[model samples]
Target chain A: MRTEEQANQAVEEYADLVRRLCFMRLKNREDSEDVFQTVFLKYLLYDGTFESAEHEKAWFIRITINSCKDSLRSVFRRRTLPLEVLSEEAAAVPEEHGALLEAVLSLPDHYKDAIYLFYYEGYSAVEIAEILGRKENTVYTWLSRGRALLRRRLGGDCL
Target chain B: MNQLQEALRGVAATQELKEWTRRRLVRERTRRRSAGRKGLAAAVCACLLCLLLGAGGYRFYMSPVSYISIDVNPSLELGLNAFDRVVQTVAYNDGGDEIAARLSLQNMPYQQAVDEVLSDQVFQSYAAQGNGVVFTVVSGDGARLQAGLEGCSGYYASGGHSYLADARCLDEAHTNGLSVGKYRAYLELSEYDPSVTVDDCHHMSMGELQQRLEQCHEGAQSTQGHGHGEHRHGHS
Candidate 1:
């Protein structure tokens, strides 16, 4: 059981871990915020107890993904927008980087999340699988598929 | 190296997460304390009264006030100052590092108002998002005022300049010249009651404090009157 002080510290130290996980899974900035809040509030209320930092990090990832799933379920009834390009307004993309972000956003949610976590966050495929509650092969498949999709969308030989 | 990574380098998480976390922790502490008490009859009355006021078109529960606070994680503090601009999901600290945020809301009916602010597209586009906030409704006089760091209740703020701090909800104590403190009844999750007994307990001149209380009461009551005025044809 983590003490209040340690719990506070844990939240502070690994907040980015939480953000990265949410960013990968949800794609949209707004839904990501909703999931992020739900994750921390749950951590504070019931799941603050963790045996190790790794344990806490894994827990945050799992909860964040689940929260995204919950939001996805809710979106069945409520009109939902893609997380990458918000429907409320046009994203102000500079002429240079807009195409690249749009390509990343076009991938399936699972593929997009896996690719970002693996390449950007430097998580091993095994670790990504563990956080995502999937097998190693699944993570590999997502990464491969996501990269192919990004390559195709960007129409570049870079892989 | 990847496009996503390149995008993220320029995509900044906002700085307001610190404020959200601070407010959340304090509100969490307050809610836990309130639930420990047994007498919730008055609280139920207050909720009913507010609901009736809303029904009558008083708009008592739809106040636009919001409370915000920032807390820097020692580890994340270094990177906070790098953020370029403020977005709904992003805020930049003074030192220029970025961190995620969490929010604690003391009022439930006002979630719509808060959602309006949080859901803005400019605010929503950033990837560095804060955790979901806990919203609880408490009754009180002041809306947004700087609170002392320790207690979760509202104190008798004397001057005009209240810091732009995370304001807790205060309850009106009808007896003892309307005691100033956090309202206990409106919490879902809490750490402790936000009520604190001041040292100069006797310093509260009943007349002066009562006048203040009456002003607040009249304000709420006047709002209630307006709400009822809206429903005059419906009820009759």
Candidate 2:
């Protein structure tokens, strides 16, 4: 079991990782916060131990994915948050890129998951397959399908 | 190339949780540690006491006693371990009539076991005395009492179906509603003896209640057997 101080330090160091995991799935700030707390509470209660930073990151990713899936299953109520709800940083980005990211979120959950893991986290297809409990070929198919859908939705500008 | 990543970086890095949540987790962790330490200390003290008692070799005297009635539904009674006290009296409502029933659940394990059983038809049918039923478990402050009834409804619905499925009808009797009999039970969880008291408010006989409970239990066993054989896998 990690000491409380060590756990808190780990949370602080990986705050951004946790935040991105939540943002990528939930697409809302408040819901992500709830998932984040639940994940840490679970980590503390279960005495989750890791050998290294990569192990910790992988565990956190798995937990985040499970949390998001659970949220989707249990909380079916739609949150009416708008697409332009990002910070001034995202607002400062080119409109075309922003639109592309929005289109990515609109994809089906499997494709969205594959695309996010591929581009955002920079996981290889095989790693995505292992992480998602799917075959490598399935991951490749989803990535290709997701990219094609995005290109189609974003038109010629996506290329 | 990295501009998209940078834009995604800080914007995604919002303060994820409230300060209170962190404080709550810390407090809970500390409390759990302190509680664990206290439990360890208590265990050591108990061992020391036992050692001293053994050195003295003075055997603790015991008494022999018999209970007045072997209450099939003990949760309805009030008293000590023997369930000889009446903590409170209650009259439950079922349909249009007020039936005389009592609630009592003393032994928590018995209550828990009975509740688990009742949550399935097999166990619940056994607890029924005539039209009245007994509740074995009473959780703190009647919280378990409320949940217990809802659990019974689900149990009954499933039990009804399974019971029908097994019966060899002339043409597999297409009866739509058989287990619709309203069950009126008295539930009580006291500081002493906590058990459920079920009287036949519906005037159901001892034989009918037993059969129902037995059939349900049989169905539950078969269902459990089925669940075990088919699916034993979980996410890796």
Query: Can you give the lDDT of residue B105 in candidate 1?
Result: 28
Among these predictions, the greatest lDDT belongs to 2
Interface RMSD, model 2, angstroms: 15.4
Chain A TM-scores, one per candidate? 0.76, 0.80
| Residue B152 lDDT, candidate 1, scale 0-100 | 18
Tell me candidate 1's fraction of native contacts, as a decimal between 0 and 1.
Answer: 0.10
Best by DockQ: 2
Candidate 2 per-residue lDDT, tens place, B1-236, comes to: 44336436544444435354466568867976797688678757755775788843222111101111111222221111212122222221231111113223333322342343345443344434332342222222122222223223332222111100112221111132111121211110110112322333234432354345434433433343333432111101
What lDDT tens digits, residue by residue, belong to model 2 across residues A4-62? 77668656766667666666666455677777776666556544245677656765675
What does fnat come to for each candidate?
A: 0.10, 0.12
The 10-residue segment with the lowest total lDDT in model 2 chain A: A72-81
